[model samples]
Target: MMKKYVCQYTIIRFLPYVETGEFANIGILMAAINQPYFGFEVIPSKHHGRITNFFDQLNKDTFRETVKVLRDELERVKDNIDFQTPNTSNYQDVAKMIFENIVANKETIVRYSDPRVLITNDPAKELDKLYKRYVERDFATKPHNDQVLEKGIREILQLNHLNKQFKQAKVGDKRFEVRFPFVKRMDGEPLKIIKPLHLRDKEPTKIREHGGTWWQKFVQLQDLNLLPEKVLVPYVGPLANDDSYDACESIIEKIRGLDIEVVQTSEESRILEFAAE
Candidate 1:
């Protein structure tokens, strides 16, 4: 039997006002002493409505910026812990230091709940479980099919050693903002927008709606001349004889018509060729 390790974690909360003492759980931080594991997960900025509603006076842009800074700090702490060759302190001590440094003296009140201990074989998995239970439960409903597609696509990117090149990117003029899920970049190559189209919804209407939205955006970007020079869309074809597949096909055609590249996720050679170029 695999031995379970003890993991300590705290829920990070954002308090709009310290006097009122009300707060919203925004993230989680976990540390496993014996395993020497440290990690963190934060609520995405897109799902910050609860924070806004909780604090009517809060500046939404400022709050989001602050959260981004805090996340960067957390990443720095994780890197330090991971690369620490000759660590002088214990894991618990390092965890506490990270928590305190992040929460110390910011305009918005950020605090962590009392550290709680749990026994788990995989600390990272436990962190995700807790995050989904607490923070994600209050956020938007993400389709399970989309989640699976994202995971699968990420695996492909990782296997090809191209994961680091892809990142969230925004491209547009001041008047409009277009967010791409993944943008691949290399020193000498033009930016490549890679989006995994999720069209496996059970409802045909939903699939059509999703497709329509992307089609509209493509048209708008074309009109504005804001479309990227290279766009790669990976799509999983729908089930055979399914009406929804028709809608999915329509979207793929629309994307192709816009001069964007489309490839099946299974087309490893094609994807790697694109990545290499």
Candidate 2:
């Protein structure tokens, strides 16, 4: 049985006028002490209307730019803490500091309720749950299309009776490492690695960033000679004529150059054939 870890989280809010004390929940930050997990999820783009309504005089562009800057800074802090690199403070303290920095101005108010604790097998999923509960009004109606590719791959594995043979695997040496989504073993030795790449994000920038990150990892693994022999990348191809499509294509080409197999999620027959082997 997997151990359940305790997580503490706070809701990030925006205050247009500090004196008025009126604010809106704009994002969430979560962290766990015993685990190296920390992340932030922001309100969806559709929620901009709530901000504008709350602060009739606020400039939408300025608000967006501020949020972007805050997110970038928070991500930088998370990276340092996650990697266990040299940092001035501990993870929880740094999280609180970043939150304070974001809400320091009069236009933005960052206030978190008393920290709430929860036990979860996956901290990331718990963060999503909190975000949906506090931030997304239409959470129930939203489709979980982001997980479609992964679900499909898992289904194929189960259908082929290969689910028991595969487990999550880690690659790389002590200096750096990455967890492959799934790995199949033959006689207790890793035989193949499976990675699911979802390239159908609504934002082109997200698609580009995801592709670039994976490409960099592939390069790193190649340099370290840690590239698996029968690696499989299951991808959800982006819509035609969209920039995301181009981004996905570029990543596919790079992975293929390394002789790793790339299979489209829509290619159900091909996926099953690969899994059967």
Candidate 3:
């Protein structure tokens, strides 16, 4: 019979901008509980170009330097485990101790997720599999970036104990509907919509196009009287000093022209107050 050992693993996330609470999985760290196996895999520099393109505003060196530091630390610990004193009888305990130390709660850009358990006879193969599924994940379509913005708002609401009051829903007739991430309803009909818009695109034209799409939806929904009584849009985008700020603001102004509420995504107080009403 092939022996199976239990293992624990966590994703290593790279948060380019901690303020937004958005992160990307850059690596995987897997450690076995009953064996002397502990290994890690991180995205190499060759693939960092894709990350740089996605986070265009970031300093390319920021990620490189941080990841290098983490990798070096992991290596140091792995080396220590190899030269343990004869007094040390339990390699598993050493691996566990080292794993916990590395994944301890961190506020820095490189952070670890909650450790997850799995059973595997092969930790190295499992690490590679997880690394491919997470760190090397396909970025073109999981709606990953948009989900991050929505998740930030959801976490804020959850922290305030107001998350249960809203849900993801559509607030219009079958023919014309707009799905919102956070919505409040009255008697099964939507009364308020809390929408988080991602306008932080590298290109100004892309920002306007996205905002314009929502603008038209608002207009058409208004024409049909299906627009909710209140709409709170929390938008994230380039800064005021950036060249693309004007385009982002233009779309925001247009949405406001329609009497829709717009607030900066960072304005949690305004969003919370609006949600409470």
Candidate 4:
């Protein structure tokens, strides 16, 4: 029979304005009962989506500070678990104590939910499972997934030592604006704009619709004469089945017609070359 261990877990939340009673799930903490297993995962402020948007009306500085404090404290506790071999005889109590300690009542922006219990064979994987279930689910990953795609492209650029040349920017004239994840400016004017297009979808229509949104943005930018000298769009597409090929090709054609450069994500060389230039 496979050994099974019970774990106590809590969902970490950020309560920016306590009066509003609005709290966002920002992380998860877990500890195994009867076993020396403890782990945690917190959504980094940079990777946070809805929480950052929620902070718009609130103070960004306070949000970040609170998140850092919570993460730091969690890390400190987790390290102690590693240093001291938790007594197996009392580990069940230790797990509950730790969970309760973390969720204790406090006036801070950080808060935790009531303790929940689960049985798992792997503590590390279960911690990740809880984070995704509690944190990512609360944010709704539709657009968040698109942001994740853009984030990956950013990591690729940073790895190639070409990230410094571009920065997040709004490219448009005074009357209109569209945000691009990576942009190069010339004389304070939008010079080269690089955007990651996430076109991978279960349905082809959804893919085309997303592409159309960007296509319209490009058209308006060109009409305003604010279009960058060069636009590099690295897209992920051509779904596994044959049905998506036509939609993918059509969208690519539509984007390319605006005199914009479109590169499939598989073409890493092209992306690096565009950024390097």
Runs with alpha carbons beyond 4 Å of true place in candidate 1: 1-144, 185-190
TM-score for candidate 4, please give it: 0.50
In model 3, the runs with Cα more than 4 Å from the true position are 85-88, 138-277
TM-score of each: 0.47, 0.48, 0.52, 0.50
Q: Could you give candidate 1's per-residue lDDT for residues 210-247 as a string of tens digits?
A: 56556666666667787767877776767868878887
> Model 4 clash tally?
0
Report the Cα lDDT for candidate 3. Answer: 0.79
Model 2, range 1-277, lDDT digits (tens) per residue?
Answer: 8877677787776665454344566788887654456788986544566667445456787567757766786788778766763343475555555544543443445565556678899989989888886666322311244346667788888887877767777676654455666777777656777777876755564455455556666676677787668777878877787756776787689878888889877787876666667
Instruction: Compute the lDDT for candidate 1.
Output: 0.70
- Among these predictions, the greatest lDDT belongs to 3
Q: Lowest-scoring 10 consecutive residues by lDDT in candidate 3?
A: 137-146
lDDT of 3 by residue, 1-277 (tens): 8778789999988876554344667899887787777788888755677777555456778878888888898888777886772235588788888899889958678889889999987778888998877666534423465678899999999999999999997777755666678989889988888878878766685576567667776876788899886998898889888888988899999889888999988999999999887
Model 2 alpha-carbon drift over 4 Å, by segment: 1-146
**Number of backbone-clashing residue pairs for each candidate, in the order shown:** 0, 1, 0, 0
TM-score of 2: 0.48
Superposed Cα deviation of residue 88, candidate 2 (Å): 36
Q: Which one wins on TM-score?
A: 3
Instruction: Identify the runs in model 4 with alpha carbons over 4 angstroms from their true place.
Output: 1-139
When 2 and 4 are scored with TM-score, the better candidate is 4
- lDDT against the true structure, each candidate: 0.70, 0.67, 0.79, 0.76
Model 4 global lDDT (CA atoms, 0 to 1): 0.76
